[model samples]
Target: MIRFHLKCDQDHAFESWFQSGEAYDKLAASGMVSCAMCGSTKISKSMMAPAVSTSTSVTPPKPSAAMLAELRKRVESASEYVGSKFVREARDMHDGLVPERPIYGEAKPHEAKKLLEDGIPVLPLPFMPSKKTN
Candidate 1:
């Protein structure tokens, strides 16, 4: 895996691991890469130098599967699933055209980027929302 330091149009910097340089290029071209802070899809590689970690360096622990599962459960229980209409629903809520409530749904990368650019707050949940049907 190769790690690249990337920044979004909003100038938030974060590092992500890709399978290879080509993998990063393809994903970026497809607008799949997003900012870790704002979820913006307009990302570019930032200038970075190789890091050399010493013995004194500390690493953060990864969350366990159990923890992630529990989080998914709580979020799913609290939010309404809006499916493919996520972008419109979220924008309506943000604009006060609809009553604001917790919601989870699907969005294309470009849709998400537009939402962020419009200053609407949204987040990508760790798990796909279960589709609700009558």
Candidate 2:
């Protein structure tokens, strides 16, 4: 995989990974590449520094367990726990059948995929909803 720094006609910059240089060429030539900001298809590769390895390559610090537990608490406090009716409640809210509100709950993988495919914006919480905790 190769990561390329790209710029659009509007000067919007973004990076993307491709299987290979040939793959990137094929996609770009076919107008598949587009500006991440404005959706313009006029994309071009920008100059990028070569990848290098050094002992000083920084690794991002991991968040502490306390931080995660605090996050879980804050999220639970801010959202309603919908238990397993998550999918129905979320879909209902999306379709305007119910007032839109923050909710968290358990959902099967397939159900989550269906919601995303339908463009109903759902995100996975790092921890299970508190209602389901033992």
Name the top lDDT candidate: 2
Question: Candidate 1 on 1-134: residue-level lDDT in tens?
Answer: 57899999998877777656776786677565666456677999999898788879788567568756765666666568888888999899768899877778899989987886776656566666666551
After superposing candidate 1, which stretches have Cα over 4 Å from the reference?
Answer: 1-61, 132-134
Error of 2 at 75 (Å): 1.0
How well does each candidate superpose onto the true structure, as a TM-score? 0.53, 0.53
Candidate 2 residue lDDT tens string, 10-53: 99887776656765776677565655456677899999999888
Candidate 2 C-alpha error for residue 29, in Å? 36
lDDT of each: 0.75, 0.75
User: Over 4 Å off in model 2, which ranges?
Assistant: 1-62
Backbone Cα, N, C clashes tallied per candidate: 0, 0
Residue pairs with clashing backbones, model 1: none
